[model samples]
Target: MKTNVYGDFACYYDLLGWSRFSKICAQRLKNFVRFRGKGDETILDLACGTGELEYRLRKTKLRFVGVDMSRRMLKQARGKNKGVKFIHGDMTSVRLKRRFNIVVSFFDSVNHLGSIAALCKMFKTARIHLREGGFFIFDMLSPEGLAGWELVEIRRKPGYTLIINGFYFPERTLAEITIEGFVNVSSGDSSGKTTYKHFLQKIYERSYPLDKVAESLTKAGFGNISVSSFDPDEPIENASRWFFVVS
Candidate 1:
């Protein structure tokens, strides 16, 4: 069984300490919208995990739609933000009839597509549901960033422990991850104790050159393209994770 791919893992992803990072990215997104969005209030969160980003931005006067492939993840996200609409679908192929003012895929989620064609599909999907002059925002891992994936990491979060082993294949620009961990779950047996359940899974991510991504956006008919570090103010050459903005 693929223990960490989805199912139970999706239910406990919030405990894996992703909220802090999501909050940072949400703030970045907020800034981007304020300075560049041109009065667009509709948001599309691609692969929105646990809806944490949406919850973080709840104080804002924006309508949100979240799409994720994991049913359990979408369930968790929906539970967290009842007003936000969430759909179960793949990032590469999901389509929403309504166009959004801003479409965002953060946390280097684009790398998970594992191939240029899959990434193209996601970009086209974003293009399809994007309003004219709307901004498309996403982050990706560079080849240099993928090069750093050759290690074993251990993380102790508030409610879980995560162990991950990473392998990078230069020829394919693929990073293979083997994740194993234990998530603390509440037990209603009146013992006032928690149980840690084990999980394991594998994931593959691919790295692409910025030129390739820019070419795809060009082919998608996007204009005013900009690529920078996760911090929009910084340059991309030295940054591991790069963010793209297309208008």
Candidate 2:
């Protein structure tokens, strides 16, 4: 099995408060799907990190199938969710040979595709998996969003201490986040000494302007596109992230 970028970090994803955001996203997704869903809908989630969204929607009527490139992340997802199918694959090229009533990629996972060309390929992949008139809803970090994340912060918890540093290169439209930490992996021995494990990870994301994003979706053969802020109904301007609903 390939140890992807998420590797060790997968163990602490929810502990780091990342999963908390899934609650709001799940509700938004439920609302969007309920408006058009026929109560027996199937959803395809690309880059479905740790299946947090599924956990948030466990009571809903939709059936979810998740795909992610990180094997470690999928392991965490599979261990936590029941009856939901999880697959290992890259969103830019993976195919299931079946269509879904709705396709979603949340938490700016599309930004990891690295470039506009890769983003276009991901869009095409979503279209291929979507049934006719089905919607592809996703979100991306805006340039403003990336800029806001350019900071260094230290967090201390019960068993771990984490140092996070964020950097943004406007010239390259790239954002890099480095997470360095030590976790107390073992209880104290008779000598009252604890075992600590050190881990380091770097995550890279890229942002594009609205026009370029729309052009790529159009190139992917989508005729209808909706752009908004995180709310999915508010106008897009200076927000942390933007949502795209393309069909």
Candidate 3:
């Protein structure tokens, strides 16, 4: 079982622009599905952190089921979203018995798998849950894109402060992100006294060559695979994340 890698971050996952990004991704996905998927179909969302995507698409008639490894993230997701089923499990190996018309893992969640073998397992899991002719869509960190994330940055706001340090190892095609932050916690005693707790989260991600990923997808029983950079306006050579569409 995976540990609570998103323990503290789950509390603030949407404090940044991530929620906004989810809206954009949801809209784009809706457009993609309009062309590639039947209008009324089931969707399985792997690594469905905080259920932001489902919340954004709540108006749609499509049904959704979400799975994630983090209990804390699921807690928030369940609390905020209704009529969508959420399960706690690893994306690489969980089985739901039920199949879906579309399976998606967004926000570079696949990068956290850390190796090609794990990615292959994830691809298989997606295939297992997808109905015949269904689609599997995922995003991954691109080595060329990860190259620009090597830096240190800090953000301070009322009641909290966050610092992010990022490093990319060319030799290993890996990226490491360290996020440390402190949020003020308040409680009422005989007299009200405020306290604070500090949190530190270190995340490691690995990227493979496109060819290697495509080959793995092929072995996982997917055909008609397509890869594109995440941003339509940006050149593929400069984007840090790429999307893989398979059927």
lDDT of 3 by residue, 1-247 (tens): 1333688888777764456668767987899888876678799999999999999888887788999998988988998897689999999999999999999998878888877899899999999999988999888879887766688989887777889899989988887888898777666576678777788888777788888999999999998898888888767766678987889
State residue 163's C-alpha deviation in candidate 2, in Å.
Answer: 0.4
Native-to-model Cα distance after best TM-score fit, residue 232 in candidate 3, in Å: 1.5
Worst 10 residues of 1 by lDDT: 1-10
Candidate 3 colliding pairs: 145-240
Model 1: CA > 4 A from native:
1-5, 38-40, 186-194, 231-235
**TM-score of every model versus the real structure:** 0.90, 0.93, 0.91
Stretches of candidate 2 above 4 Å error? 1-4, 188-192, 231-235
Q: Which candidate number would show the highest lDDT if scored against the true structure?
A: 2
**1 against 3, candidate with superior TM-score:** 3
Candidate 1 lDDT over residue span 1-247, tens digit each: 1212366667667777655678888888888778865444898999887899999988887788999887888888989998789998888888778898889998767888867877888888889889887888888888888878989999887778899899989988888887888987766688988888998767778888888988888877787898888755556787788878887
TM-score of 3: 0.91
Instruction: Give the per-residue lDDT digits (tens) of candidate 2, residues 1-247.
Output: 1123688888888777878878888988878876767766799999999999988888878899999998988988998898899999999999999999899999979888788998999999999999998999999988888886689999999888999998989987788888988888786667777887888878888898889999999999999998889865555777679987889
Highest TM-score: give the candidate number. Answer: 2
Decoy 1 TM-score against native: 0.90
